[model samples]
Target: MTADRITGITLSSVTLPLKAAISDAKVLTGRQRPMTEVAFLFAEIRTADGHEGLGFSYSKRAGGRAQFAHAEEVAPDLLGEDPSDIGRLWTKLVWAGASAGRSGASTQAVAAMDVALWDLKAKRARLPLAKLLGAHRDSVRCYDTTGGFLHEPLDRVLENAAASRAAGIGGIKIKVGHPSPAVDLARVRAVRESLGDEVPLMVDANQQWDRTAAQRMGRALEEFGLTWIEEPLDAYDAEGHAALARSLDTPIASGEMLTSVAEHHELIRLGAVDVIQPDAPRIGGITQFQRLATLAEHRNLTLAPHFAMEIHVHLAAAYPHEPWVEHFDWLHPLFDERLEIRDGRIHLSDRPGLGVTLSEQARAWTVARADLREGTGT
Candidate 1:
């Protein structure tokens, strides 16, 4: 048999329109407007032996085109490389785009290719991604975030919360920081009342709070017995988060906004968060994510992966310590396979790789495309 060499790579940009505008603390603070859609950059790798693999990275509200463009520029470097050498290929793509810098859009672009390579390898091994990574469990604790976006009314939020628990989701996370601390408090109180004491609840400030507000909110929220308070302050404010973690009984979680492992290292080193929340695509890809995971595990931090549940459920399961994976329904239309959410957890499927194939709807949503072959680019 011919050795499996990457023969071609195709990148597609798909726009997933939201049923209604999505708003969170960032929008409420005037830092960003309501999000009407999400942009996904999909990388499909075709190997010499006819195997194909797919992986994606996403952007909310902006930078879709930038991620796609950056990937296009550097993807030609991937042709003829061994697909099994995912780490080395990731490094090659990073250096190919080094002039554009390494963290934000640059690494985000490389993340798609990096993930695809991993998926390809896992599929070749005929194992699900979590199994390929040596899963600690078959399922991961799950929480719902989409149902509680700040854009919805309080009643709708409550309804979503009740429905989420009914659907076997283990926990609920609501956006806090709506410009009125009192409103946030009222919402939390109502949700707590609705969900009762047994169900887990989490709140996210989305980094709208200052030190004073975070301190005040942290104290006020202690009564609720939340799972954790996420993004209580600016993501980069390690010292502030460290102090808050020390001061409050409720665990503090952040780092989802950070775009690299080195940046996450600073957050971990500062002892800023008791529960660490990292988004794999935002930080790089699975390779980079595993690096960060090792560091977090060494520190013995609670793992709560943020967003991209299809991807994160697998990563979370592979964690030795129990981990929580955020459930967001926004990306559901993009894939044919639906993750099983039962018994308050996301369970792994028997299918190989990520267990997802692009839906026709996903292909229909494509707004841009590019292709690179061993000898030519299209």
Candidate 2:
């Protein structure tokens, strides 16, 4: 039987305050400010046959106000398309913004709808997303990536690391670049000392350093045994990233800013990064990521996706060397099915589609935030 076509698309915005403030101590770019909360643009797509899918677009900056605008503007373009023909739909949307540049905000907007289509397709197939994508393993490994210097004290950071390790987490990621390389080095060394040798430790500077500083600091911290260094330079600096990758012994990982497979291809061909971290919300959704993963596989590299652990957990489970999924702990309160991570492995649910549903209370709570509706416009 032919799959039902996409008949309608709806978009909405929500803001949720973080349990604690997230600060980038390693202010590599803009002035470091305390982030009040996260904002998301959630899209729901419905097909002619009544199957539906859900996807979200979010940002730590501006709480997703601009992203929501992009989604609202693009929704009409997706009306009446075949949900099953995700590739075709993605191409149309990518071309919709061809005159203006298909990569950044436009691509992020397309990713939201594309992900919704994939979710809808999985639900229509009556299969979990990982199964629909072709599951390579039953459970995927995950690492905690939420211990920020702004909220968690040094003692608390160690405590969280210990708790995660004891809980059977296979890896941990710490935030760095609060401006002092020495402090960053100390923090990473402490975590490594605490976790010992078995559990992998990753660090994200959040685009906090220039090439020279990143190389200098990265080399200093290399002795601590980091699994990878993420976003050390600006996300857009492919050549800088390549230089840093060549300079360091630890793997260089970036690409949360990437929006298409072409960019990934260039980065791979240039040997810009060792590990590729594509955010499903930023990179034209799951279909493009699958294609990128295939390319990375052929190049003898690993796929370590960034953010949205709910979605990445499924994608990671379907790959051969997708070692770790980033665990930010932001989506737990919003969804009914909080992922289960036992012994560092994320176990997928048997429920149809993505197996995530927003709680009524959460929806109401999100709607009640009037301040977020004002839109910070970052």
Candidate 3:
């Protein structure tokens, strides 16, 4: 066997083009063009034994380069360290960035590294990431966020939901927080009317509203029986979320913007959200996500992982409780493999690691690349 130590790390930035601009309440409210570019930061951790593990993080519009730089900055700390020691490496990276990046971009960078480390561990064990993490289920229910953007026409939105349902997807979520509560409500109502009562429907406001608006809109939209209302207000408004949670029947799902497991604990301890939506890459990757998942299970909260479905599908499947994964096809070009979504549920593959590898399409999109060796750069 080769040295079990991590020898180097390679990084790349993939510029993904959206088929069309995608808008949500925040885009409409802020008057910014719906984001048309997705920046994907990829990390490939190489061990002395010639095995490599793949991990990635993404920015909706910017910061992909910054994340790659941060990952490079942390690479030295991982040199000669066992890839199986995921926890130690994660802590090391977190502490290294604590002064400058206790959260946000630094944490996002850590996510890419952490995921690569986990993939290494799973591959060494010759088991899939889910099984390595202790599989709670082979699949998880899924909901599509693709069709329900604020910019789509009502008919298109309805058709999107109908198409998703007809495909056997379990549920669909649309964007809310349009300028007018009535406008947002009308869209929700229209989807409800189209889908009828049986299918699950969710709405994401992208934190575009204030407490007053969230409360009012949450109340007004309550009639349609939403599975949950996502980010009705700002993500950090714990007290506001608690109050709204108490007032509404729909569960409040948040935490995607939060960058640490400790932050998730604060959100849950405060009764801030009924369903926790943590993004693995936004946090510190798989290790931190497992911590959050354990916390959610013990706290009796539902787990609904935020995007990067390719990575999250495995994590959600390993969650101790029933979990949901958001469906977004924007990253399809980045990976050679993807988890399957059938009959509205996502099934994880048994292949070792995260079950995905960078695709040639991803290679074509690479605007920058680097290979950092153990003793070459400091």
- TM-scores of all candidate predictions against the true structure: 0.99, 0.90, 0.96
253-325 per-residue lDDT for model 3 (tens digits): 9998888888888889888899999999988788888888888999889899998888888888888889899
Clashing pairs in 1: none
* CA lDDT of each prediction against the hidden true structure: 0.92, 0.77, 0.87
Please give, for residues 94-121, the per-residue lDDT of candidate 1 as tens digits: 9999999889999999999888988888
Give me the candidate number with maximum lDDT: 1
Residue-level lDDT tens digits of model 2 in 257-295: 777788878778888899888888877788788898888
Candidate 3's C-alpha runs over 4 A off are 1-3
Error of 1 at 209 (Å): 0.3
**Model 2: runs farther than 4 Å from truth?**
1-3, 26-30, 365-378
Better of 2 and 3 by TM-score: 3
